[model samples]
Target: MNNYEKVLVALRRVIRATDLHSKRLSKNAGLTGPQLLIMRTIRDLGEVTIGTIADKVSLSQATVTTILDRLEHRNLVYRVRSTQDKRKVHAHLTEDGADILARAPEPLQEEFIGKFQSLHEWEQSMIIASLQRVANMMDADDIDASPVLDVGAVLREDGWKETKKKAGA
Candidate 1:
């Protein structure tokens, strides 16, 4: 196959694997990858502001706030209007949040991160450069991507409902 086709196939594999893992995480633990990530961040950072969580996860504050809304609806977390600074909001994990976190799967990036970190510095740099080059070639440099590994676009798309229903069944 041509290099472009090969790269597409590889990217497809990576995307599918990520989606499957996210599905497993949700089915088994009732938490999306991003939800689990926010929970873990709150746990690690200890009652931090929404901006802090956004910064920690490399997600925009609005995206973080939206997810926090979902999480709050599910009673996994609560937001407190900071007394010291009324404009600042802090996120705190509920008991249920802590328990879910205890049972949650590893972050989707954990394995990839471990292996990536094990590579030589030069190899790591080469991979980063190559991936960025591919992204540029695909005209994806302007996309608002985050480190959250749940395949958010696919998950939110029209077909995702049918796909998720079938997967859940």
Candidate 2:
């Protein structure tokens, strides 16, 4: 194949890998990537505000609130208005949430991060630059994105439903 075809193939593989991992996570852990991420953040931060969780996860507060609402519906998390400040609410993982999180597989990015970090600094920079160039070439350089590596409309509460519909699942 030509170099450009090779690049396209590599990008497709990355997307497919992310899609497959997301499916596995949803099947095994019963949580989407963003859901697990938000829950884990709440667990780690110990009664964190939605804004704080949003900052920690590199997602918008509105997106975080949506995910939290779903989690709350599932009884995985609960929020309480701070007594010291009624306007500020804190999120805490319910017992079920913590239990599910403990059993959930590690996020796909965590595994990638470990391997990426092992490479030489120059290699890391080259990879970053190359990916940035690819993004620019595709006119996706200015798109809003977060650190979450999940595929689909991760910003929406019904994102997975839309993905499934697109795939005719």
Candidate 3:
């Protein structure tokens, strides 16, 4: 294959790895990456507001709220209204939350982050620069993204089909 084809294949493998990991997490833990992330944040922060969790995780409040709603429904988290400021809501982890968290698999980035951080400063900077350049080359530099490794966090129930329909409409 040509250089371009080789690059494409390598990229696909990386993407596919992420996709497969996401599927495994969903099947095994019944939690999306963002959900696990929010759970961990809640556990770490004690009683934190939705905005705080969103800021900590680099996710939008709306997205966090949506996932929090699901997590709350699952009884993994509960929200309490602030007594002093009744309008304020805070997230709290439940017993089940703590138990599940103790068993959840290492995050998708756990291995990657460890190895990436072990590289020398010069090598780290070079990788970051190269990755940024590749993102720009692919016209994805400014896309809203979180540090979470889960791909298609925004997709739900064949979002692609709906997007295709809208594009052709």
Candidate 4:
């Protein structure tokens, strides 16, 4: 195969791996990558606000708020206005949220990061440069994306239904 074909295959493999992990996360924890991430951040931060969660997770506050809405609807999280500062609402995980989060599989990037960190510094730099070049080549450098690696919408509850519909499935 040509070098370009090989590159495409590698990219496809990466995407497929993310997709598979996403499915497993949904199946095992009933949470999307972003949802899982937001919950984890809330648990870790304890007294987090929507803005705090958004900043911690590298997502927009609006996106975080939407995800929180869904999570709140499911009884996995709750929000309360602080008496001292009613304008700033704090997010907290419910007992059910903590229970599910405790059992949720680690995000795919956790494993990737562990392995990436084990690489030599120079090798890491090279990999980063190459990936950046690829992004530039694909004209995706300007895209607004958080650190979440899951495929599809960050917190779409329906999973792949939209993709399937688009594909005429």
| Candidate 2: worst-modelled 10 consecutive residues by lDDT | 155-164
Model 3 agreement with the true structure over 56-144: per-residue lDDT tens digits: 97777877888888888999999999999988899999999888888787678878999999999999999899778888899765465
**Runs with alpha carbons beyond 4 Å of true place in candidate 4:** 155-169
- State the RMSD for candidate 1: 6.6
Local accuracy of candidate 4 as per-residue lDDT tens digits, 1-169: 9999999999999999999999999999999999999999999999889999989888778778888999999999999999899899999999999999999999998899999999999999999999999999997665555678988856363424433554456
Clashes of 3: 0
Report clash pairs, candidate 2. none
A best-first ranking of the candidates according to their lDDT comes to: 2, 4, 1, 3
Overlapping backbone residue pairs in candidate 1 total 0
> Clashes per prediction?
0, 0, 0, 0
The TM-score of predicted model 3 comes to 0.86
Give the Å shift of residue 35 in candidate 4: 0.3
What is the per-residue lDDT of model 2 for residues 1-169, given as tens digits with 9 covering 90 to 100? Answer: 9999999999999999999999999999899999989999998999899999999988778778888998999999999999999999999999999999999999999999999999999999999999999989997654667778898748356545544555566
What's the C-alpha lDDT at position 19 in model 3? 89
* Model 2 misplaced stretches (Cα beyond 4 Å): 158-169
Rank by TM-score (best first): 2, 4, 1, 3
